[model samples]
Target: MRKLILLITLTLSGTLAVGQTTQKPPLHGKHWMAITGKPLAATAGSMIFNKGGNAVDAACGILAANCTMWDVLSWGGETQALIYNPKTKKVIAINAMGVAPTGATPEFFKEKDMAYPPEFGPLAATTPGTPGGLMTMLAEYGTLSLAEVLAPAMEMAKGYPIEAQTATIIENQKHLIKEWPYSKKVFLPHLGEEREAPYPGEVFVQEDLFQTLKKLVDAEKEALAQGKNRKEAIYAAYARFYTGDIAEEIVRGTREQGGLFTMEDLAKWKVKIEEPLQVNYRGIDVYKLQEWTQGPAMLQSLNILENFDLKSMGYNSANYIHTVYQAMNLAFADRDFYYGDPAFEPKSPMKGLLSKEYARERAKLIKPINDPEIGPGDPYPFQGEKNPFLHLLEKQNEVIAYNNHGTAILGPDDPFLESFLAGTTSIQTADAEGWVVSVTPSGGWVPATIAGNTGVGLSQRMQSFVLDEKLNPFNVLEPGKRPRVTLTPSMALKDGKPYFSFAVQAGDTQDQNLLQMFLNVVEFDMTVQEAAEAANFNSYQMQSSFGAHESKPGAITLNTQIPSWIRGDLKKRGYKMDFLERTSGPLNAIWFDWKHGTFWGGSSNHGEDYGIAW
Candidate 1:
């Protein structure tokens, strides 16, 4: 009995010691880190880094795993990014946004009088650019074989335990899953009287996805040899999955359900890469994906912030938050009014959207505590400078409310209605250890009830559009046109050296969230972990807490940690208010500890994702 008791005590001590070591005293190495919205996705990226892959390779691995983990953001969806090449001291933009099908047009939608069918599912789908995007990056910069890089994802899809966050996502978005049989199978297999996720510790498999990737690897060498038609071996494989066999299955299933996707669309689709938008912020150059997303708008906001004394205002204080939101509203107003893809309009305003003079003009409209209603400002004219070449309009118009019925402002209905009306933003970041940022690509809360010509439901990409008379809304849905997105994947450079890479998910709120977070680090001088974990407000026009987009009433969100004194002071100044118990945006980030040559990364616990490094 004495010997047995001693043995039991020894076993308990051993377990405790193991747990202590597992806590990990911060990893040290030259690593390529990936910070994404999911733990499994991050794990896949870290594995690639461990296997001698670069940031690009890690990103591909993460993208694949993310598709299986969260259907809303990957697989046949758009992907845009900013990649930094330390060797050349240049940042490359991988613009994998889908192009408008040659068949899309504004007139087409107007003819139908349907407020641009929310483009989600098959008919609204653009040729998925991920294949081309990943391939292009691999062909240019990757050292690992594509087959090797893709292995982790194949393994993940075949079967892995579902994480707590992913399960919560499944529960929250059950409606989207119930719409289609395949979606339901992957999301919630019917379990005796009700649907439930594959239990934790149970192997979850995506046979179709796994089979599809295997086919790609088996034929990659042959596919590369021929431009149009690859070597027969690879060509046959790609056709069987993408066009011939698997394509037929997708088409048949879609048709039975009522979708507009056809095998021809998949066969004819190709990825398009365009010039990235560039801007200057306080002598530092910034780059982002073009107008199809709100990338340029982030550049514009930074440009405006450069004209202000953010560091002096203090971090997360009402004063600082006010300035940030004002800048965001001004930029977003321009976004709603002018931003869009250049190929369609040929005269889009994105080119001059981030001009220093333009930012200056936009900054002039902001009064310290005046609390002007939301729509009473414009960026171009506020800069206090005039353009000689272009005829600029001087407008400070107050917009009418969406309905003017004075909707009830109290009770559960109010919050529920507001939450329903807002959109979600995703964040991605890359570190000096090769971490990167890719906030998920879609826009707002889509109407799940509306089915596309393809039996699949539409995503809320239409919320990106705003009805503006003078400048064509950049977010308008044209069949072949990519909508203007707000996914801002960014890299920070200090003294021309790459400092960090970060991205957030929050639709139009992306720039605002990023701006506050960056200030939390650069201005407030907080530690990387603190900057990543700190609660911040996004002053963009999405959440009803900021009043209506049309109202444009100035407001600021306060992290609960903020002192009540600061909140009361801001309220006295007439700033409208909302207090978030949790940080509103999901931030994934990585910083290169230049001093130690190590990477420290964190994925926000506020969101269900995990941050990973090797």
Candidate 2:
């Protein structure tokens, strides 16, 4: 009877989202499942999975296809991933995030009369990381050759029917794309025509990009001919990208466009495989990338919420909503001040920041009304050390107030929403063998500057760095330092086995929605699809990581479906509210059904995210 009502409610509008649980039906895969931001990318994963590759190989395939299609990313972006190694029974973290070049410093940007890095152009690029990340993951864990893994993307570069999303993005960004000579040549093929960009179904050919891909493949083939093993051959291809002709062209192109990249910056950068951070919520162990990313914020939120009986509060009720919002803001407050690259000096208090006791102390400060002035707490004491940056934390709000003068304030409904919007996508893959991989690869969206003739887009992740120590002493930009990023992929283990792999693309709101989605599944017993499709809320209380790096205190965005009573309750609690039909997500997930020895995949209809299984 409930399903009938849902069917009627949906059919009245138009065609179904092809299938429906929340528009898309839950897909059950007995063998394997591949899901990503675009249907074509997911198909690439399926193509590899069907060819006997493991989850890691298929994931690498999808990553490559996503880059080729430019689904909010390009070859020169960054990639952070969480992989469950079935043989080792441990989750591993892959940090392929690029770092600041030799001349990148707070003084350098401030000299340009800027508070933070620019949003576009060569000056905004970081060292390329996605290519290295893809090769490293495939060489270490995949069974197929590099040529086989990149076949789909190679075909795509040669020529493929363009989707409306990419076509429109290219056309709209043509003005900026024209600024870079190489990008102009590649993205605007019909410059003066009525529609400079290709039509929706027109074949978009990237001959230069095809040659670049061909060079890497050729490098691998030459290495194999010289008797190199599969892994060694793959690394040979990797070397050609970073230190050979490809690197030379990239360096020349970026420098010609006034970028900071140098041969040293590209060569010195390498992928890091480290242990993932984890916090047990109830019996489920949730894992996230370390402090270098905002991933730990989600872990911290779970710690605070674990103190409450969320199941009793009921899902999306006024009380439940309030508790979760307070927890996210509390966690993000810490993220803004304390998260940075652990590889650098004055290491962040990750121990204390992720401490459960510290979360309890922070939760004590939550009031009935939103406290707009909520500042960073002293986590060092929780780790048995004195706070080294106490003075810095004291004047945090004053610094924010000063920065707000330069910040742009836009309402929630505006297309140019100031906070919580980034160009990114999530890749989730799992197979029958217990191999699971989750990734949030982003940067180098459309309007990206193409480096020389390489056809590789440069990452604009440099804007994530702040030039002032007063804002984030831990994250102040310097040569070879990684800026604190909002990209986070997630994994969960149940009773020492891979239980779930998930991620979403929403900048600062990434963890806020992820926290609610986790609770929706664990506390409320919703299926993976239901949890993913659930309308979660967003709090614009924390500062934006991009653009002007502004914050909107007490501002909240809610789904229109919330009852008037609940809305009034929130209003009475001093929340400034705004409503939207779809307030959150493009979240993708895969549940490992251990008992049944199968996988359940969920791709949100809120976006172009799609999945395939058999």
Candidate 3:
């Protein structure tokens, strides 16, 4: 280790990374840019933009289309987004995350002999959030009608070529799909055959889902015929989904599937548009959705990271990785314990958690070695208030560990790790009119239980809740309380102008990969595409927000391309090193070349993510 440090000292060039050449060419656009988790989805956004819609409208199009294609998500999931409305000249956050339905208390799960909520099934669902989210964004900020934005998705629902990835997932999880009658009907078109699921490139048709969408469009058309304006017409459609026959079907279908969703749960749950949380790092303002979605953890990391000279350590160096890893663990420790829906009592110590002085205190705790004992710190004291859960908080730290989440020999398919990196998709859109949007929408992937004939997939986000206050006092499951989620969308502004918009699809690793990608651009001079393809590392030391909520302290994962000596050095520092061929994101991003007055889009080369700029 000493020899490696001396080597790093002597060969700073080796430690510091240089600019990287990328496999895919950078995307350049002037009129608009659309990038997402799928090619057809990006085209959906482009189509809306071509129809003279702004970024928010195009983003809704991309989001709805991805759900229709089951790009690891569906309409009955959740949507968390940060939009930079040029009209307001400020970033706005949409809280479309669903809450637990009635009778979904901690005691209910404990009585079932479960540690947490089930990962799949109707019992796992929260009230649907995506449809309300899409309509809210379109109605409030977008110029186009709901029918206009949903056209592409409705078309795909009628019949679109199913991709290999989604089709294989259906085939692999056929048994689970068969359990849900509606899902069995929609997903197993060739049931009892050798291949139960649809084939890749096969024209898959979702008549029920198509009908569901048509009903919403029909509602809009009826409202317009009655002389309602565009926004009012959109809300009329929204009301029909949440309060009319659609909500009735959702409730009836969910109840029949052994789920719990009431008309009240669907109607009472409304989309919230609020100012997002922000923290400035070196004069650049980074914005994210609030604590409800684990977004503030990234802001906290940036606060602590502001105290370090990451550029001097070289990108992804042992020192850099360890520092960032420790910082993420620190922020996530707080996330596990304090982050929950702020609407409830005993709110998170946002005033203290994001405090620069508190960050300095947390930063001071980082040692040369990984600290397995590192856990949640007292942000309440920093904020000058008595902690409401101080007694529980002490025990919470000790309990924030797992005996075995992932083994050194375990494959990526290990249940814990796979769940840790599970579902969702991201959408990024920008227009010449100055509208910008970033969205991370997730839940209800394949093998999902379709709620009745509503053709909506139920969200499995209820698993994100804790059954014990000792685990997370704020996030303990309760009726009508939103679960603390891992989905986060990110954006940054520099000199009061949109700098970049970025987000990814994953569970616990969403912010981890996003933090590294942001640093790849801000700290290193990597272009957006280079950053997207860069070899990144992961620290499994923090408590995961997905299934099992496991934590494996001192565990670090890296790409095979990392230098052997750096890997050895990290191992010497007590990191249980895991290697993979690709560890970075499927990160999707857009960099604004403010001086040139254009957009530079980066779609990750690691996944099926694609982008178009024109």
Candidate 4:
């Protein structure tokens, strides 16, 4: 261990700080920074930064480690990232999410007399897209050789012990891991026995995964040859994984175990890089993953919040949380009803249903204080530049406006909206002063499959359908359709400079965590760690296929710290409350360097991660 540390320090040309722990310092000043869900992964990103890689390069590095050290939560899944080039002042998004097979239909399950399996199933599985997306980013933006970028992950895979977080996930999802022989082969030794804790610091190796990576890495040069598209080479690697002997064996194994993913499906699969959903919040442009997930819903929530007085409401107070809950409900109601792959018929009240002008009108319906009689928002609005939706908010102002307190009141029509509150948020603040927010819902396709051979546990992401039963435009389930993901990665810019980048990883809890973090930083001026450690809440006031553990219609769940007295008062206001122990979302962030051109970055001690620097 000491030798490895010396080698790393020497490689990066840095002196060891006295009494420095195993973790590296946050990259300060014009240097690059990278963070991830795991310490090793973050270290991988840091290594890339030290090797003259930029944010994109560091991202690739972290991704590599995610596949290795954080396999359970990382790869063999979807990926989405938001990137900004400070040099060019341009922001771009990458949506490399897996998609359902073209031949897949919800009715297929019905025909099989099968419930849409929760995690792994033909329907739950989509063609994996992360590998392709990584290749795309590397080809388009990365400066390091593929070999260099992947080296850290390979080493991590071959050396060291299992991380605590990875062990926990392994234990939590033991059913899924133990069911497959291949999976058990990789993780069981560490666990010692079924349901046992993975011994901390125990060395683990993913020999198969390493070989797969090596295979792809070995093809890089041949792939880059003239007249041969680099993207095609990348796709070929996946093809081999899914359609060749590897995929055939997976399908055969899963089929023998009664799983339904087909080789034809894998062979025809492709990763699509779709355009991100765009919105304007406070004149600042924001992009989300579209209808396949909570990306657009998050934007809608922001839009609704714009109509409220959050700045004056005071952060995390009962009143503040109540208002945000209402906003989220209103936004997500539309999401559940209208979002799906746009290539298929999708329904959205906000789709020409509400224009920017109409959104302004809808904003007027919200009140400052709790509204016991929240009304159902209009599903249809008058069309065109001059739409009747614009007039709706104008008409009802007199009856609801609070004469004494200047707040909006709930009306009869409010019952159309469900009342629950919950979501998670994650933020990454890097040494380069790069800030991002990534929030995703947990209820998407995950966990289940009919005990399979290939060992790929599929997801039920198809539930994110539009009202007309079509997939959301951004979430179409074509060969390459990225699942409609709720993951929203956000960055805040102040005075034409990057201030913060925050991303949340919780499936549904993303929204709540993000709202709190923003308040902590922008309103309360709390440091990143404080915001992450603070108790949080979740509200589910919308009709969502995504189920909440604690939320019920017209109700919410708060961390136990929420005063019990507040719960009684909230119930009286028609809000149901469930107090919980430890309802937290990992909130990772990097505060930008305002002086000396260095960035300050950190991860939530709330999570099993560390910050890395170059």
Candidate 5:
């Protein structure tokens, strides 16, 4: 065990160095691999792979470990994953996003004179979907037992050296932590004394959380003793959290704190497995989740850009950047206005939105100069229905005002943005047999205050729901409806086989970064590592998906690596540009070269992300 940890540390040191400007080669392996935001979490996933477990098993381990190690990814958060089964020759989208509680209503917040749910309190929490999501993946797709996969994460919760990034996040949110005694007890140092945040290298322990995870393991053992199979045992373990004492404790805590979540909501929550939406670009089929996420926006943008010769425009050229930005703006405009819970409105215009014909029509609006007020297209015209938000899609001459008051943006010096930009912990694993998994497990961090002594936190995802019922019926706060989230994981298939799996963590930039990285490889012909390290740009031209739903029309942020001339040229073209020290989001990916029987893995250097292939 000591040797394994040592080897992982050395490998991670090398991998981290590659994220710098030196351009180190991608990590290559012939069998299997795992890459994630944190070194310890990656090590956990790699251990699962080394033990002969498949990609789904490795991903379960990775998700558990990430929840323990990174404050940004909590056990109580939601998870949106994409899995590809080589045996079935199919891709499945897992919508593990939590739903608003029954009591979550527009009138509930309107009485308080607030436009949205509180960003960091019990009121912001919903029924957590991560546990159900992980257990479901294990029961349906993985070969390993719950006890086996959760061991590493339990060990991490017992005591692990705090990483610099996690330490900084703790420090930044110390004030919020201080607000809840249980939260402060779990995250801060000297619980009731000086209240110092943990620093890098300090051993951090969450004994309560360790015990909580242990209960799940014990429940799985009990189920197995009752003659249940591995799958049934996994489901039994999920029940322990969702329908047993754990749920009771969470309900009591939230109710005591004046929150709306109830035991009924927790018991009824289930992760949905649905078909993924795909679009072929350059013979590669790119897949993303449907309406409940910002994923389709990327597919729409790709569809529009597919009509242009991006290669001729030159990489990062003003023409290429402007075109991509305009296309993304248009897609995001549609996302804000149209995308929502399909369950609430089964007639979501997804088919028409992803149609190539719609993309072509939307592309016609792109001009040489920046169009500051690009709005959602008439998808209803193509879908044979009336567009409900058409009236709200008015264009304005002035740049849309940015309401930054309730946003999560801490400040220029705050690590919050960089923490997310470093990307959430995304895990990808492809075993020797060709089973592939791409899972983005996030939520339950700084903005989400911890629940009482249940050893569980809650997600602030309720922030994504709108209080105005008139904005769009699809996104209006409603019981049992999932909010349109920004957590998107992507997969690509070539020749009917899994080619690559990738994801990013930044809110609005998640799909944008995915699209850019995909093109960087397929169109620009760059290696996985090179594509991740390459200069990248993201636009904020459309309304943000987070708190307040503010828009910064024509706003774009460019990596410093982009040449000065390119920035100068973009500015000359009426595009609003800002310089960032590094890529706006961290991109993690694994590329499978089936013909050569090799796996190449890469991750962004922006944060503490690392990749291990062996």
Candidate 6:
């Protein structure tokens, strides 16, 4: 409904001479932008854009560079992306997430004397989806070849100076790295020398990783030389990783290490391009990856919040935070209960969960004070069926005792409990021609063993799956079933035109942080930078989507900048509040103002995030 106005008014009087006047209008230009949680990745994407490539090309480059940030991203991890093409006026979602091995089963883990798959070994690894995902994007929507975009990342793998955060992460995981020979060989110092973590200025190199990437580039070259077109060459590169020697090495190493990945699994895995799930918030259309990820949680929360006047509630106020927390809790409740890979579902539940009427009905259950246990809604009523998980949902109300491995004691003193949170990196790119992309590439984090000498590590994503046999229909272990990943990227359009692209890199806190940033822009009318910098809070009132699926009812953590009075008000309203030195997640955003012909971008300054506009 808001439109940019451009006009000049002039008045003439009964004088001998006439004067003309004009009003200054907002300046506009074609904008090229890129933002990421790391400076090098942002620079890499900008380089691609500067070289006359579109957003898809820049996105490929950015994702490749992100692999170097081993502290926050994984070289052999999974990726999910949303790309908007101005040419076709269509938005596409890429589900490049990893899947469970055919041999993975609860019975297998139980037989091995484990309650669940070990989180740091070969048994925890899944078939990586990044290579296929990136190549598919290049083949379909990208302007440059894979080798061209990946050149910067290959150089980074050859050698680069370590950063402070990465240094700290490596130091913390040193003990775990020592557990695996290949991991120690690649990440730790030599066995006989004084084992020390790489310092901030110290050069860190991964020659093996460099060679692995070069192999893919060589495959592309070979294809090109064989008279194949660019798309075919890209596929050749993908095959090199998924169906060639790389796949063979992964399968062999996984089997040797007592894992279950097979050549057939690798051959069958491919990135799927599907339509993004969307919801209308105000006049804007927000898009996210489907239920396989936690992306729809943001949309569901928005749909619930759309019932209230967020602007009147005031930003970050007790009422505002409480309202958002309540909505988020409800949405997450549904996320935990119903979200899964649609390929495995008997029927799609998204149509019911995304229905505005369903959101309104769910929102009516929100209380001024946090509900002790707000379970998933009966979305199936809209689908004309009884809720299938009603019994399990009711059972979740009873808190289960957690067996802390390191500390038997409960409370803040438990070392195992305190070390639960983690972070990731996000990248967003948009070219002047209006091709936009938002990607969250993650997995293969530390404590996980590298796949033999291939330089590619396996993702521990299988840990996100529920081991309970009763929950098998949703989020349970199954061959080729995608994990219910917390990685979510977002895009929005105003008046059916591309408006902004955004994503954050925190586990369960991702959608929470994204919702806050988005509302800051649409409701509080903050600039992209101001919105990203604003104080934020995360609610842990529902079960986490990670290991053990812990839930802390009525728990909320806010940035220290939030006023004490607001914190006290929330406490008075029956909420437990905690404060962190800074916000939980690192966020990145790129906004395009079509009417003004301008692009604006922002990245969190709290971490190594960088935003570049040209």
Screening candidate 5 with a backbone cut-off below 3 angstroms (N, C-alpha, C), the clashing residue pairs are: none
Local distance difference test, per candidate? 0.57, 0.89, 0.90, 0.56, 0.81, 0.79
TM-score of each: 0.80, 0.96, 0.96, 0.77, 0.93, 0.91
Ranking by TM-score: 2, 3, 5, 6, 1, 4
User: How far is 233's C-alpha from truth in model 4 (Å)?
Assistant: 6.5
lDDT tens digits by residue: candidate 6, 77-154: 899999998889999999899898888987888787875566678888778888888999989999898888998888
Instruction: Indicate which candidate wins on lDDT.
Output: 3
- What tens digits encode model 1's per-residue C-alpha lDDT throughout 466-488? 32333334455565556665556
- After the best TM-score superposition of candidate 6, give how far the Cα of residue 596 lies from its true spot, in angstroms: 2.8
lDDT of 3 by residue, 88-179 (tens): 79999999999999999878889999999998999999999999999999999999998899999999999999999999999999989999
In order of lDDT, best first, we have 3, 2, 5, 6, 1, 4
Better of 2 and 6 by TM-score: 2
On lDDT, the stronger of 1 and 2 is 2
Model 5 lDDT per residue over 1-614, tens place: 99878777966877444244434567788888888888898899989887778989999999999888864778888998999987899999999999999789989888999888776788887789899999999999999999999999999889999988778778877878777777778888755556377878999998988988999999999999999999999999899999998888778877777778888999988999999999998799989987888899999999999999999998888889998888898898788777889888644699889999999999999988887766667887777778765555552222243222233223456343343343456888888888888988777876456666676888878878887644445688888989888889999999998898998777778888888988889889888888887778877666666666666566677877788788888888776666778773678899888779899887876666777888
Error of 3 at 299 (Å): 0.7
Model 2: residue 605 alpha-carbon error in angstroms: 1.6
TM-score of 1: 0.80
TM-score of 4: 0.77
User: Which candidate do you rate higher for lDDT, 3 or 4?
Assistant: 3
